[model samples]
Target chain A: MSTTSSVPDAHEGARNDQAPAPAPRGPVARPGSRLLHRWVWLRLSLLLSAPLAWMVLIYVVALAALLITSLWSVDSLSSEIDRTWTLDNFRTLIENEVYRNVTVRTVGVALAVTVIDVAIALPIAFYMAKVASPRARRMLVVAVLTPLWASYLVKVFSWRVVLSEGGLAEWSGLGSPGYGLTAVVITQAYIWLPYVILPIFAALERVPDSLLEAAGDLGAPTSMVVRSIVMPLLVPGIVAGAIFSFSLTLGDYITVNIVGGANQMLGNLVFVNAGAANNLPLAAAIAMIPIVVMLVLLTAIRRTGALENI
Target chain B: MTLSSTARRTLAVLTAAVLVLIYLPLLVVVLNSVNPNQSMTWPIEGVTFEWWRRAADSAGVREALATSLQVAAIATGIALVLGTLLALALQRYSFFGKHSVNLLVILPIALPGVVTGIALNNGFRGILGIDLSLWTIVIAHATFCIVTVFNNVQARLRRMGTSLEEASADLGAGVFTTFRLVTLPQLRSALLAGGMLAFALSFDEIIVTTFTAGGGANTLPIWILNNMFRPNQAPVVNVVAVVLILFSIVPVWLAQRLSSDVEAAR
Candidate 1:
């Protein structure tokens, strides 16, 4: 946009008598001019240094503190800070039965939610992108996206009322299995559904209509057309959505607290440690586990070019 | 080759069923809010707006709402400035470690809220010896909120390209002036969209707030969580939830509109 506007100014500069004409040069410059160019380069680099260094410093320091704290120990009763480094915190997490159960449950719940969300979202996204009328499509997209704006706490809290005995589930003849792994899964799936849906819809929108039509014209079955064309095109989006759901559910503690009853996910454990136990080191240590997992997954996605697609 | 009438009808029924399933819980909340009875019965006997009025009158709920708004606003502002700056720097420059910087920016958002909460709590309280308060909540929120703003601005920056800024530089405008007059105007939509989305995210955040908020520092969501089980407060909780849902809907709707405009313009 600015390029077109600058042409007149460039021409004006060219026509001005005060401005020197451009001098064509080979690889060499006058000594004085070279010195001036070097000075300018030095000044520009100096000007850029502070902000760049500040950003790097902040990132490093924050991460370093977190890492170092994770290695430290905690006094059990008083919850006082102990400077001595030990592997006990990490070992406790690994060896503790409750922590192990929570870790498995957290991963299990996230996976189940991601799978169910993807299964439900894909067909609707496909329909909205390709089959629905423009108005209906718009409405459907809006409907899916609207729930995301609702307060996260309120949404989870609402699920408490909804999944409890004589709540929505009971009203609908589905028995309320109050505050269990099942409720956690249902609520997480509901919350994360839009996250999965929006990206998949965006991805499906990229698939050319002509390709689908051509497939249909070639006597391809609906299933075959979906398999051959749509599915291949949507892999990146689906992966992106799954990553979002998985990571979100993995990190989430609120839903598990409100719905999972006695089930302690990593998030719940972190909260418990931080708030009740004041086991900052152990909490920090547990926190690193999710970050490591996320980084590994993100790196794999980037290598596959799916990160860019997202 | 076409789907028969019966098949299409069945599909339509299935779609409607799923929609109903998705919406039922929300519908129930809305219904129960107005129910005059003590128990939240299915039929929801004799609707009244008393709960809504009660929610408006409740001092604790009002205070929480105000606190939530203030924290969210501050967090959103911080995110908007930092995120836009980072986005511009990453987009305009070809520097070493740019990829790592980008990853770092995205890391907070991708990591679970609990992890972020715990990390920030540890850093602030453990390392810095600072008490958790509204500022702590804002900082924690801004950390994640940065990703939203960065994503929006980066996407806009990619679409816009660097020609404008380069042209401004060529015209002898100072870098700051060029950014203000040229780049800022181009980024207006993204800034607004990002700001609104960030505000929504921060306003609704619970996990981070749960960790960062100290004694006597309760946001609306935290307040709701605490009062959700109380019978007197249950109706108020519903009212607050409805209000919050409405508050978020406006920004999200605006974001959707802005995005659609950008899409169409592209």
Candidate 2:
């Protein structure tokens, strides 16, 4: 709607070519006009420079501040900030049993979630990409995307009801406490499944059906065709989806806090330290651990061209 | 040449099962919200509007809803304008450090939400000594939401090509006038789509909001989080949860429909 209206102005401008030519020539004969053009260009350049420079400056400052805070140690007695630059906070985090446990749990959950989500999403994505008719494909895509559109909090809250002791399971005659590691995994898997599915769908759509038909003509069995042709081609998409889901789940605070119950993921620990404990330095340090890991993983993915595939 | 009937049936069943799994929990919450009994028991003893009525009357719920709407609207607005400007600038001019600028713009959304949240939290509170507030949440959200807008606008700009703008300039319109008329119209659907997506992203965001919202700023998500563990308020929370879910889904559905319309038109 907006783009269509702008066309006429361009058309009108094209019709006005004769007016600027004579004015420019008259101005070109005067020294003042030459100076005016230079001045105008200079001002325009400066005007553009300010916003661009501001963006770069703010990014640098924010990142540097985070790095500095992540390095600082927290006072043992009052749990207040100790402004000295030291590796003590990192060392303490590495050695602390609770921190170690939470860190491992976070990674384990994230990996588990990524693997499960990819496993579930791949077949459906493949079906939509290869098997479904155009109308059916569109319907399937919309179905997959619908959950992503729903509120994150509402999704988590719904999981609480579904997984609670007396909620969906008990009502449906599948009795269980409903809140534990299983519940947490299910919630995270449900929330992030679309993230994995969308990229894989995009990648699978790029593969021509003719190649698959050729494989089938060569007397390859279904399983053999999948293993030899489809899986190999979809590796990059799988990796991209895995990275997205893994990193997102690793840093998530809500899923673990809501569904994990007694289980403390690293994100939950960071949230608590920052919110309840008011231990900003410790929280900052905890936050840095996941950031560093994500950067390394993403860099590896990009170098492998997996991200570009998505 | 086609799949066997049994195989087709199996695949259809599997797809149906997965869809059921995807939607069951959400359906359960909506059903349980109106249950007369407070407990989320099976067979749904009786349907009632008690929880919905309570949720509507709750001051905290209303306040949180207003806060979330206000913050998301402001954040999305800022993101759309700034992001559109950034996209135009990058599209028009070739300059030094362009790669770095592109990286900076993409970094926030590319990085984990926790990292961006922590970075903003640390920068604002520890380094700048500013208290966390609604403004902080808006700023944090805008940082990432801008990327969505930028991606949308830039993609459309690339598709439209430079000829249209150049033709406008050739006809004697000033750059600003050209932008207002020729360029802006072409970018409308992209902007609208981007703005809606950004608003939805900001509305349901919890991680960044947690870091940037101090003691006082209670967004709807945060309010729900606080009440999640309270036994008496669980059903009421369910009502709010349903509302929030509807809020996000509606905009996303509209955006999807808009994009499909654009595609069909083309």
Candidate 3:
């Protein structure tokens, strides 16, 4: 709802025309009118100011400060920030092979997780949306959403156990990939599946049954129908789902620390630099990677109308 | 579309299998919480309530739970107010820079948690010259948590036109009276869902909490992380996880039921 959606005062008065005549404006009505009616700006200001201050002063300013801090560096021995501005942190990030490798590895794993989630979410989401009875659909949604409320650490730790030596994988006669990038990707994909499922299910629900029937009546097979008609409509939702898994995976450090064995992502790099090394400047610089990547991705998806879906 | 029986059968099987796969690991966690072996090795360990008993007695766990509850409650409370107001402003008044405001609201969630963490960490320590504390965490959480409340309230307001509020206003009731009697009643379920979601989100958050929380404080997630590597505490950690996962259903179910009630009314 925005100002444009709000009915004008004149329109409201028009609706009230059918009602019995209002009592004459007494002195008590004058102050109220002066505040809420005579000055629309005051009403708007009262509603808008506090929240705008919070979003701008706290969130936006903090982000801007972080961007500036990335330009500075620290003195190694003293462990104090040098206020002198330089591109040295960015230069180091560029020249360092480990940072370069970690960046590439994180992006690849994020993409893998997104792909895995989409592949799994599609058929299940479609089933929930179209094939299931209404009660069954509601039950399915609750079943999927319950795990989301479960603690994130618990879920990741559960994966750590499953991939542990002599765990379920071994019990079932399948060798576990055992704590590494593979485990990280699997755990990330699993954690984000419900999230991706909901959006895709909503998108699929919007596809009218008549359109699908028309395609089927025209002799197109199920696969052909999904490929041609439903797929196009599903793209925005898919893009929206992909955003959740990819960005969530990219910035995740705790999951990697638990499941990634010796592997490190860009998150680990930043975590180490910030927490372990206490090199905030370097950490802030490293953070630019994911922020920039996400900004670019968000802008690209805005064109697809996936941003609104999100 | 009328699918062949074979195709429908295949899709159904795939969906069922995926659901099973999703729940399998979580089932393991619940079982592990009761396993007798401290090592928690594979192959059918005997079950016992030892971990549950120990977890109940732990002071650290108690303190962590208390901290987590307080943080979530305060954060959710702040988010509820701020998010509702923002949603009201955005939804009711056409204002300049509304698109920018929308982007601002979405960024905290869309950006990597690490980025949000460090940014707030830096701002709290460097720019603001404030100590990292529970207040900082609540603030950080409110920033991100606003989006859920905002989205819910915005959608609710969109679905509910301004007619009732206008009628109240046209009846000679002032703005505050109209909001109190008409608008708030309309917003009750939406607010309930949004507040529960914000609470859930804050309770589960770790990365940003990791950065914002002072050295003295440990929320439940942080507590779990620290205890996970402690050999004696691992099973108790499992028990804690089980409790939380079990408790998760309440709010989610309530929220779902509430929203469905609205739909059924319509």
On DockQ, the candidate that comes out on top is 3
Over B54-105, each residue of candidate 3 has an lDDT whose tens digit, in order, gives 9999999999999999999999999999999999989988878988998899
Model 1, runs deviating above 4 Å: A1-60, A295-308, B1-11, B256-266
**Residue B82 error for model 3, in Å?**
0.4
What is model 1's DockQ versus the real complex? Answer: 0.42
Show the lowest summed lDDT stretch of 10 residues, model 3 chain A: A1-10
Candidate 1 vs. true structure, TM-score: 0.88
Give every collision pair in model 1: none
Model 3 lDDT per residue over A45-139, tens place: 88889989999999999999999999988998899888889999999988988889999999999999999999999999999888888898888
- Can you write out model 1's per-residue Cα lDDT over B32-138, one digit (the tens) per residue? 88988655656676889999889888999888888999998998988888788778667755667788878777776777888767877887799889998888888
Kindly report the interface RMSD of candidate 2, rounded to 1 decimal: 5.8
Please report how far candidate 3 places residue A36 from its true position, in Å: 1.9
B-chain TM-scores per prediction? 0.92, 0.94, 0.98
**Which whole-number lDDT from 0 to 100 does residue B119 have in model 2?**
76
Task: Report the C-alpha displacement of residue A43, candidate 2, in angstroms.
Answer: 9.5
- The regions of model 3 sitting more than 4 angstroms off are A1-34, A302-310
- lDDT tens per residue, model 1, A122-189: 87786778767888888887777778787777778778878776677787786788898999999999
